[model samples]
Target: MPPEPVAGPAADIDSLFQRGYDRLYADDSTGAVRAFAAAVCLEPGHGEAWAALAEANGGGAAAVQAYAHAVVVDPGGWMWRVGLAEALRLAGSLNDAIAAYRELSGERADSAIVRLGHARALSVAGRPAEALAEYREAVALRPDDAEAALELAEALTGSGDALAAVELLQPLSRRAPDDAGLHHAVGRAWIALREPEKALTALRRARDLDAEDRLGAAPLIAALEAGEGADLSAAYVRALFDRYADRFDQDLLGKLGYAAPELLRAAVDRVIGPATGLRVFDLGCGTGLAGIGFRPLAGFLAGVDLSPRMVEKARERALYDDLRVGDVVAALEEVPESWNLLVAADVLVYLGDLAPVFAASAKALVPGGRFAATVERSAEEGFTLGPTRRYAHAEAYVRATAEAAGLTIRLMEHCTPRREKGVGVPGLLFVAERPADRPQIA
Candidate 1:
C-alpha cells in the first residue's frame, strides 16, 4: 500500500518517497520525478530517494548526477554504483561510462552485467576489438544468457563476420522464435551476407512482432524493399554524429584524410578574394573545422549543427559568435538575407533532396553574398545515396539547383573531400554568388 499525501509542510519524506514509487509504477514518470525530487529536497542525504529520482528521469544527465549523488551517499550500495554507470552510458558519456564499468569490473570480475555494459560502451566508442573481448568475456561468464549471446552476435556482424554472426544467432533465433531483437539481428546479418530475401523476411517478422518499431527494423526493411536511396532520417544522422563526436577530429583528419574545409576555404578565397569582415554563417559547421578557416574572413561567425554533442565540440572552439543545434534548413530559414558568406563542408551527403537547402541558402545570403559547399560527386543523372549511406550529386544537378535558387555559380571543380577504404572520394567544390541585380525571392 502507498502512503497518502500529508497536508502542506506536514508531508514527511517517507510519504513522499512512497508516493514517488506509486507514481513510477503507474507509468507517471513526470509525477514520480516531482515526488522524488521533493523527497530529496526534504532529506538531501537519502540515497534511496536520490536513486529513485534518477530512475524516474530515465537516464539523462540529471539521472547520472542523481545516481552519482546516491553512490556518494551510500558507498556500500553496489546497485547504486551500477545505476550510476548505466546512467552514464545512457547519457552518451561513453568514455566516462567505460571508466565506471572498468572500475566496477576490477572489483567484481565475474559480473556478466558489468562486462556487457562495458562492451556496449566500447562498441559505441568505436573500439570494436576491445568491445569484442568484453563481449566474449560476458558470454563466457553466462553461456545461457540469451541477451549476452545476442549482443556478441551483433558485434560479430558489425565487425564484418556475418557468417559467424549467423551461426551463433541461428540457434538463439530458433529458441526465441518471437524475440524481435533476435530477428532484427538475424536480418542485419543476412543483409551483410547479401541475402536480401532472407533479410526482408527476418526484418518483416521483427517489425510485425515489435509494433512500436523500437528495434529499428522498419528502416532496414524499407531500404531493402525500395532498392533505391532516400534521405537519411534526422534521428539517424543525429545519433551517428553524436556517437562519433568524441573521436570525430582524430578519425576524420588522421584516418579519413578529410580536407573539405580546406578545399572550401581555398575556393571561397578565389571567388571572393581576401576576407573583408564578412558576416559568415557555417551550415552544419561540425566541430568548427570550417569555422576555424573562415574566421579570418569574418567579422562575425555563426554556426548550426544537428547533433548537440557535435555542437558542444564546436562551442568549445570558441570561434562562432552564435552556435545552435538544429536542422540546417530550419536554421537558415530563421533569418533571411542575414549572412554575407555561407559555407557547408562535407555536409550535403546526408541530404538527398538539395532543393530546400539551396533555396534556404539563397534566402539566407545577402545580395551578392557567396555560398560555398562540397558534395560527393556522382556520375548518375541526379543524386544517389551510396553504399556508405551518404549522398553523391551529379555536376549537372548542382548547376541546375543553383540556377533555380537564383544564384550564379562562379566555380565548380573536382576535388577529393575525404578518403574511405584507402581510396580518395571524388567530390565537387562550388562557390555560388547571390547576384545583387537579381530580384530577391520572397
Candidate 2:
C-alpha cells in the first residue's frame, strides 16, 4: 500500500526537518530557523530538529535555548553540548559558559577545541591566571596551532608579562606578516613594554591592514599621540568594568583601600546635616557601594552606570528603586529637576572634560539640590589623563567649571579617596549646590 501513507506529527516533523536542512545548506538561515522551529513546535521531543534550529540561528540566546533543549532530549549528543556551551559564551553568559566548558573538559580532557573555548571564556570573565593555564594546555595539545599561540601571547600581555608576550608575538608576527590581529597584539605588547615608537609602528600597520577597525587600534593610537586631553572611549570603559565587576568590591575595598564612598557620605552629611527623605540619584553607582550609604537618606533612590555587568551587581544590592545602564551625563540630562541629591563617588575619573557633566548635574537637580563627587587631583592647569588612563582634574578647573555651570560651590576639600600601589591617591571631595532661587538651565 506504498508504506501506508505516513501520518501524524512525526511525518510532518521529518518533512520540516529535511526542509530546514536544505535551507540551512543553501545559506538561508532565517528560513531554516523558521522551518526547524515549526518542526520542534510540532514535536518538542525532536532532538535533531532542535539541534538544526540551533545551528541555523548560529549564536545567540535563541540558539542557546535550542541547543539546551537538544542536550536535554539527547544528552549523549556531544556536539550539541559543545554548541550549547559556545552559544552561552557568545550570548555573554560567561559563568554559565565556564561551567559548561568545565563539564565538557572533564568528559573529553584531550580535546584542544574544548580547551581553547574554555580558555577564551575564562579570559573574558577576567580570570587571567586560570585562562593562562587552559591556554597553555590547548597550545600543548596542538603545538602547531598559530591561533592558540597568539591567544597565549595576548594572555601573557594581560597578565603583565610584556617581555614574554613580545618574545612570542614578534616571531609569530614575522611568520604571518599580513595578519592584522597579530600586528595589533604586537603593538599592545610594545605599549606594555614602554616602547612607544615600536608600538606606534605596529599599531599603524594593524590600522592600515584592518579597514573595518575591528581590533579598535584607532583609540589606542590617539591615546598614544594625544596624551593629556584624550577621553577614554565608552566601549573601553564598559568592557573594563564588565571584566572587573565580579572582583570589583573585594579588589577596590580590601586591596585598594577605597574610601570614596565613606568620604563622600561624610561630605554630604556635613553639607545637609543628616538630611533624609531626599530624592537621590547615584551616578556610576558601581556595585551600589555609594548607594549603600545614601540609601538610608533617600526617599527615592535611583542609579545609572555604563557597564551592564556593573549595573547587574548593583541591582543585586536591592538598594535602588530604579537602575539603568547608561552614561552618567546622559542620565542626568534625561531627568532634569528630578533629584535633590546627586552622588558620583570616584566616578569622574573616566572623563577628562567635566564641563558637560557639571552643567548636566546642575540641570538635573532641584533648585536647592546638592551635587557631590570625588575626583583624582592633578597639578596640571586644567585636566590630564593619567598613566592609568583615568582623568585627574585640577582644583582650579573643578571650581571654574562648577561656577560656569551656575552651581554654588559649598565644599571643595583635599582628600585621599583611595590607595593605589600602596600610596594614597590625591583627590578632592566637592559638594556644589544648585542655587535655591536660580532657574533651571535650558
- Give each model's whole-structure lDDT: 0.87, 0.87
TM-score winner: 2
- In model 1, where do residues sit more than 4 Å from their true spots? 1-177, 180-201, 207-229
TM-score of 1: 0.57
Give me the overall lDDT of model 2.
Answer: 0.87
Tens digits of per-residue lDDT for model 1 on 270-375?
A: 8878776899999888888998899999899999998888999999999999999999999999999999999999999888889889899899999999899999
For candidate 1, the clash count comes to 0
233: Cα error in model 1, Å? 1.2
- For model 2 the TM-score comes to 0.58
The list of candidate 2 runs beyond 4 A from truth reads: 1-181, 184-199, 205-229
Per-residue accuracy of model 2 over 1-442 as CA lDDT, tens digit each = 0012223345487788888899899999877887887877777887887888888888888899889999999999999999999999999999999999999999999999899999999999999999999998898899668899889988876765666667777787888888999899888877775557678889999999999999999998987787522356565566678779999999999989999999999999999996889999999998999999999999999999988889999999999999999999999989788999999999999988899999999999999999999999999899987888788999999999998999999999999999999999999999999999987555
